[model samples]
Target: MVKKCFFFFSFLFSLTFGQRVIFGDDMSNLPGSWTLGGTPGNYWTQKSNRWFSHSHSVKCTPYDNYNNSVDVWMMRSVNISGYNLGVLTFWVWQKTEGNDFCQCQYSTDGGTNWVTLWQRAGDYSSWQAITLTNLPNNANRIRFRFYSDGSGNDEGVYIDDVILYGVNRTTTRIFLENGNYFPEGWTLGGNYNWTKVTYRYKSSPNSVKCSPINGYGYYNNQDNWIDRYFSLTNYDYGLLQFWIYYDTQNPQDSLLIQYRSGGNWFTFATFSGYANWTNYSYNIPNTADGLRFRFISDGTTTYDGVYLDDITFDGVSTPWIDLTTLSIDSPPGLVEFNDTVSVSATVANFSPYVIGTPVYYRIGNFYNALRIVDPVQPYTTVSVNFPDWIVTQPPGTYLKRCSTAYYRDSIPNNNSLTGTVTVVGNFDVGTIQIISPTGTIDSGQTVNPSAKVKNFGEGTVDFNVKLTIGSYSNTQPVSQLAPNEERVINFDPWTAQSRGNITVKCSTQLTNDINPGNDKMEGSVFVRVLDVGTIAIISPTGTIDSGIIIPKAKVKNFGNTNVDFNAKFTIGSYSDVQPVTQLAPNEERIVNFSPWVGSRGNYTAQCSTELSGDMNSGNDKASGGFSVRVRDCGIVSFVIPYDNMPVGEYNPRVRFTNFGTEIANFTARIRIGDYVGNATINNL
Candidate 1:
């Protein structure tokens, strides 16, 4: 995981112990010990396209889409037998389907059974740090597994910079005594010709020689090397000192000193030509775990090779001092613009070294530097004060940062801290919102209008809020509203006189308000009076029979007040009036007119309301047309032979009449018991 920011403290503290990296990998090269399995085709592989720390990282389903129903994993097992507690940290970039998951698991009983540590499913655009803490004492193995369902596939997950830290560990040094034999942990490689020689010695007894024998030229095409490995964990600085004497062919046959870090070796220094036995010291990286001395000879020429002795490697714990910003002590909370106030920060030293450094503080574009004249002792805290600062920027919030300048600081992550400060005007007030009389209102009724006012300044304020709607206006006073406080002000009651949509405004009136942009607010209200109108003609519509037809109309009260009105209905030259009694607000009623003798023709019908104070006249009247057709026909009388005659086929006399003014042709059938007769008549 990557470090983000520093944390500061104002109390004395000591550095007791530090975390040591027990096992880690930068993923530069694939490790031989780590194994990858599950999901035959799609597996986790090492790629160099995206990484967190080094040049490479392990990615699941690299270069192509992952196969469905895959459970691929990359795992490594570590032997944490002696360590009590450990913390595992790593970074990952994942983009998968909603149901697909990326899981981190650990195992204690080898690679047999696993316990889940963390799992997540969804999209993460950037790399995110993940830390697993409180691992069991017997935990040893860790693995990353990606499971995909049989659905949406996307760019898979990438992992990098995996590290495991062990607590309560101490640092150790590596050294070799002057003797006639090689050390226990040391090994010889290549030609294996390196041995201890008595004649050429850097110390008292003897020194290891890379040549065949004394006073003899080395063999041609010779390559011999010796190396030793050490556990250089928990250390931040290291120095390697050794005595060397080289007498090889200049630039052709030489000895190379190299160190190994992260399983890769690099040359630190190269020596050639005749040189006396001299003490040499070189800085070694804290991450280095092994050192080597290799001697190479060309096929042409070679000399008395190289000799080394009295080799020593020591891990040094240097003086480290950390400065932390605790707090900004002056002008707390909020401040007014253009006002001067002293700025200071409480700082602490968390190491065992005396610190004499400068503290720098900044607020937006304004910054200043102050020095800590007296040396801060080990594990002590002090306050550093800068010059007074005047707030000149606009009314808003700014970030305030305080940092310490210490060149010899070991841990630089805790050097600075940041906070926020808000600036406001000295006297400012504004109207927040209108509280009452907003949506709809009734005319000739007294309404109480109210609004919410706020004090947006640094001090208490006294102001007046005024509410206006057309010609009617009222004002209310608010006294001593504290900073960042709000109050709802209600003005005197006003009677509404007009109709339709009217704009209502509320504003704050102060003597010297710094900000007036939010001082006023406007809203709308729909005003309505007593109104009753005909909505529709419910009866005598479409087609009807020609006779005494009755007309009906639907009327509604579209106002705030109730009233009694008369509705008039008319069809051709015939008209009638119906009285509606006590109609409630927003209510509807149906009015029926007297019967009218309508003839056989197409006629237009009209209905209207007669309310004296109808505010909206647009919906007072409604008209419609209907067509009446005369198609009446009936039989006046019928004669049958012998009312109770016997069951036999017989003819009967019948009479028919067409009440309509058109010709009629039809057929008639008569049946009595089992006897039946039929007749067809035309043009009566």
Candidate 2:
């Protein structure tokens, strides 16, 4: 059995102490291994009688006048770059009045430049150990100093047991805050007057409070900035985390995160809305060795401002892996029962260095596969496939998860992912869908209905398929349908005898089919009447000359049935009839008729057909009219021949009649006695 593996990566912090301390002093003498500075007489001195824990401690005091300010300093030298993590620990008792405080700072350029690390005010009753964090992880020629700002009347300050030690870096946590004091090395600007107050904190005791001082509503346009810079050159990757409490009601009040780039501040993110000690983390760019970060608050005049605590800048060395994506490799469609499934995921390395780790995969109760990623480069992803998993669980859905383990992952939330996979058990099931025989079918016609049968279950099957059309139903047998396969089944011909809407259904009757809801399907189709009627005369439809006795009328059938009718045509008082025998639908015939003779005038020719049951009478009759003009036929009567005309040129007198139609001029060839000649008779 192959073991399914999963890995989870998280940042683990381990502090290893150095066997030999670089420098240690009990401060028995007046600055034995230390240098002193500031206002001449008010410098650091060893007080053997007034000390805590040890025999003697160093002390510093301010003048009784509150007008002057001074920082009497005591210094020691050590190289902080020699170890992965360097800590400066000491015991101190401070008794300062008002706003005056004792501070610890470090110098890199032999006391030329200084960076404050911690500050303490008021008083400390007993010896308290102070650990200054967020110091430069890699800095040579570094010197630590303790100083006091001399203002107001106070009992001065004392320090004992100063120790500097280096440790092997596992995971370093550089906290910018020490107990209830405000963080040092941070600069405040604009209308922001922030102070570390012990009133309200997520962890209790202390949190930095920021507010507007110019009377609430009037400070609506006030903007504040808090900035801190660090030298995190020792670590390759960095993450900045902090907690904040704010009101989400005020939309305008916001905290904007900014970073310094090319001497100018660029905003990286903006946070607004209500939260209670919500932890937020941001990735620090690799190019940011000397990175400086600032948080700006704009608005919040009427409402309360923000309280911040637990500011930390954590760093990771290299080669971190995070599982970004997870999935179950199934077929193109839905998963079926007993099918082979493979789990796969994509893992990403967000670190600057290459990583090699073990990746694990598991689905439900079964462990699927284990793989070792050889070399996952920085900011890239590697896809891993697990071993083949036969879905043995009962038919349902199960969650599948994959993960990878790495030494350091700043974001552990993205180290694993869970997805769902459905398993269909080994059984025969089908989904029947009626897709055809759902439109207007001609009456008394046979139509073949079609349906799609899909294997929606896990195994090959042989089932009985049934089709129903209206009141008629039939069953057919189908054999060997593979899983997830579809086939179209055509039923035997179904005859539609009449006009109405009817139902078409298809179903599969299998003994092993588990899902009965998808085994049957239904649809609707329409059947139309076959008999329709339309008759019209296509010819002899326009104006024409009227003397056409035997005019032709063409009759056509525009229906779906064969029709037999009597075709009748009439023009003026003349009418004729013809019998049309068994004219098929969409067929035409020429009907000729003779009209009675009439006087010259305009007459209408009407043509129609009389069927037994005509569907449309509007197309049964068609009529047209024409102007009638009679032709002239010349007639001559009562001819008087000239007696005894002997071949002489003489005019023959005759009575002529224009009997046909119009007034006419007649030319006659006369033969009286012996005269045979052509003559033009003028209008008679």
Candidate 3:
């Protein structure tokens, strides 16, 4: 960190000194005051990295070889005979190794009489402030030399902010804040918060911190501001200066400065990511007597926001033309269909010495360039309104930006502003719903279907509404429905003759409707015939005997109505019957045919449903041949060691148990993958 230079005030008038000459080089170009000598490796050249200001800084490269050191000097000649208590002040940054050194020397009798003022040896990685005291007031035509002897693997040195002043010069300080207390005349902003904090990169013990906390529930485009109001009416020429450290860049976070003059605000400067604590000075116009300064963040909060310190408003005596402000004005929002709107902007001159030239203003796709006349003085703001401005966009929302351009605008941040507008149409309609009947209905039965339509857009609508299902269709005319209003329309009663699933569709047809995607809807329905019943024997339907056995049959109502019937089974002289009650539509049930006692012989067996009014009786009765035989009623079997066997193939042992009253003769089958084999086992 570079130390601040302060003047020591004394009670004696002759001992008081003030700043006379201040020169700061951002290395945007070569310095005019100093003469360069020795080898040039951009050693004393401009660069973008490790700078104390914006964009570029001066870099001095050290010699790499340890055999012999290389020498270089940047010298400036000045006359100090008129003023006493002369002081030399500047900033230095260096990284040096052993035996590498730099010295500050002054020569009174040209280069032949050189005298050493200060020297440094070894390594230094940070920027240091150098102030030479007790300079000889009588020395005239003296040259100051910055000599460097570089050796070994060292990174070199950097020099900036050189000032030479005496006790005779006068200066006025309008404002100063060194982080020890809150600033006066400045107000904290809304939306985002700014606080005083101490960071390792800060210039002093503390600096002002502003961070746009924009994650989680927070959104972007936050308009946070910090403002200060003061009167700059006394003098015509001055400057507004401050030091800042920025942490990030555009599309992420941004820091902007803007000030108000003559009741209209204008942007001064905008900065993006990764910058050191650098100083900036802007010329103040005489017409900016009542000025309001503001700082804003665009809400892309990342890393750290911005640190601001050492804000000063100084009164200077120089002549330079400066274009201060540019802003958009009077743009239309919520325009009706095909309606026109006017666009306008404002521009201001903040310099008293130079008159303005041609300035350009652009709104959306339109642009205009106007020339500034001689009568316009400093602090005077002029509004340029485009005469043929119109809104030609279709009905929707659009974001438009307004911008201004002038070659003399030293600060370009406040030159543009963005906003959104909406357009609307006259007639629109929507189909809210299409609904089918909630409960079951029989085929060939008349049922009422319904649909709903609404005017969810602007104005009332008179349109055709249609409802259709398969071959049945109906259409109706809606007289008038206001916005956000809905009405239910019913179709003529139609019979669903087909079986299975079907779809009913409802739609609206309006020629001028702006949004047609929401004009149609669909719903599902199921249909079948009434009073149709079906019954079938599912198991043991062939070669059955009349004995103590549990037989099964299925009875179903395949229609839309309830059914009540009796299931009967018969084998020659043996027979049994069971009643089935209230089997609803599309339902199936099983019936057991058991406890049949008969003699051994060939016979015919039948299974059927007995219903008085049964429809489709072709599946109601089923018949098959049966032969009475002596056989086992039931048997159980198992294979030993069901799991965890060796990989090789093996036929495991088998065991059988007769769970019935008689001995059983059966054939067993074993299968794996696609292989199969059978073996017969009797008398189990």
Model 2 poorest 10 in a row by lDDT: 1-10
The best candidate by TM-score is 2
Worst 10 residues of 3 by lDDT: 3-12
What tens digits encode model 1's per-residue C-alpha lDDT throughout 293-391? 888888897778788887767564444456676677765558776789788888887876554555567776544433432466667889888767777
lDDT of each: 0.74, 0.61, 0.58
Off by over 4 Å in 1: 1-228, 239-288, 291-314, 320-337, 345-354, 362-383, 393-425, 432-522, 527-684
Residue pairs whose backbone atoms clash in candidate 2: 5-360, 5-361, 6-360, 7-404, 248-274, 337-424
Evaluate model 2: give its lDDT: 0.61
Task: Give one digit per residue, the lDDT tens place, for model 3 in 458-560.
Answer: 6555678888887778998886677788899887888878766677788888655677888888776777544433356654555554465565677777665
lDDT, residue 396, candidate 1? 55
Ranking by lDDT, best first?
A: 1, 2, 3
Instruction: Give me the displacement of residue 577 in model 1, in angstroms.
Output: 20
Pull out the clashing pairs in model 3.
17-167, 248-273, 249-273, 267-414
Better of 1 and 3 by TM-score: 1
Which portions of model 3 miss their true places by more than 4 Å?
A: 1-169, 200-203, 212-220, 289-301, 316-684
lDDT of 2 by residue, 1-684 (tens): 010010012235754422124555666665676778875777777776565433567777433322236656777666767556455667788777746667777765666666655666786757787764345545333333334444455676778766555534455554444225454556777665566666556666667665533222223555666666655567665667667776533456666677664566767666566666655556576455333323344444445556677666666454233434433343222466566765567777765555455555666654434555656776788888756766544454667777664323456777777777665555555546687787676667787877889877666666788998878898987777777889998888888865568887888887645778788888887765433222444434444333544556778876655667887887766677888887886787877766455556666778888776564577778777765555464545635454565765555566666654445677877675576767676655
Task: Give the CA lDDT, 0 to 100, for residue 554 in model 2.
Answer: 76
